[model samples]
Target: MEVVVSQTAFNRIRCCVFDAYGTLFDVHSAVGVYREELGDRADQVSQLWRTKQLEYTWLRSLMKKHADFWKVTREALEYAFTVAGVTNPELFEKLMEAYLKLECYPDVRATLLTLKEKNFKTAILSNGSPMMLDSAVKNSQLYSLLDAILSVENVGVFKPHPSVYRLAEKEFDLYPNQILFLSSNAWDVCGAAAYGLKVAWVNRFQQPPENLPFQADVEIQSLNELPELLNIK
Candidate 1:
């Protein structure tokens, strides 16, 4: 759990592109808001919702039947509700609204501010829809901190896909080595690294690294440590 950096990493990085959900924003915060309504099944529903959400994304990607993240999110919610056997229209609506305004992780603001001050171009490359990302960024007051919000909607596919990573390169007009891709999702770290981007895995939950072909250039427990790891200051 301390920040781990490769000696050669970050030297050529000119941009830091982050994953939105789970990396910058807390994905479970939506369910947390409706905990009282779901009672004992709160945690179960939350976990299942997140699991199904990601599963659907990958499944859709493989099937070549792409859907926007918001659609996937709602579909996942419906499945979670069915599995949890608790369905209240009001509760469902509340959870959906909560997601639009999901709370940013505590370290996000300061880390992004640091990256901005250091003259690094920061952006969000996410599976979220543009409307969803816009709401969360505005709600978190991070709209001005980021240079771009790159959504998978643009390519009609989910991440861990090379095309998704290419959006950042195209938007920033930078090569893979000049971009530092950050994500809490280990698979994403591998995916970005496989695509030749330097990656910093923000392992906030202390999860094990993925058994993948590519490894991240750095691993840090929080975004707060990213500045130091990248030698930004």
Candidate 2:
């Protein structure tokens, strides 16, 4: 469903924080590069990898078993390969390396440039480890565009956690409402919103929202729509 939220909901925001994985970087692009090798099961492997990666984070968080996202990613990929009946070591190694340079969405650079020009403090708060997030950012040539790249590794916990949300406030020294958070994951949106950050769910896939207690202030199809929603030029 298309969300028609009021633009006024975003007028008071000062800082802009993003979720890195499915939001800024195209996560499935790893499998995309190896589609020829994987053949018909490429899509299934990619989707399952992503789905299990998220489930592991939440499960680990709930279980108080903290592991860096790099480990979780590898574990998830192994399971995905097993389910898809893919067993090539070289292909596995290739896909893993490909993740370090996942494709940047076309809308990202332009939107970040607009934010930088307008002086909005932009950063990424992701479940990825600092090494992983930094590697992806630099690989995608976004090092200069972001003010910071936050990782759950800092707090030893993942999303929807109050402490992880607190990392942004500590970095920018601003209250949650003053920071406008953007995420493609509905669950991440719920996490930031429930933490009191003004949030915009980047509904890139037009997927339905999660059945969570919190909801985003608005939903946009792309970051290109952000400046208009924020009343920026």
Clashing pairs in 2: none
Off by over 4 Å in 2: 2-5
- How displaced is residue 13 in candidate 2, in Å? 1.2
lDDT of 1 by residue, 132-216 (tens): 9999999999988999999999998898899999999999999999999999999889999998898888898999998877988
- Candidate 2: tens digits of C-alpha lDDT, residues 1-233: 56676767776678899999999999999999999999999999999999999999999999999999999999999999999999999999999899988998999999999999999999999999988888899898998998998898889999989889889999999988889999999999989888888889999999999998899888999999999988886
> Given candidate 1, what's the lDDT at residue 184?
95
Error of 1 at 201 (Å): 0.6
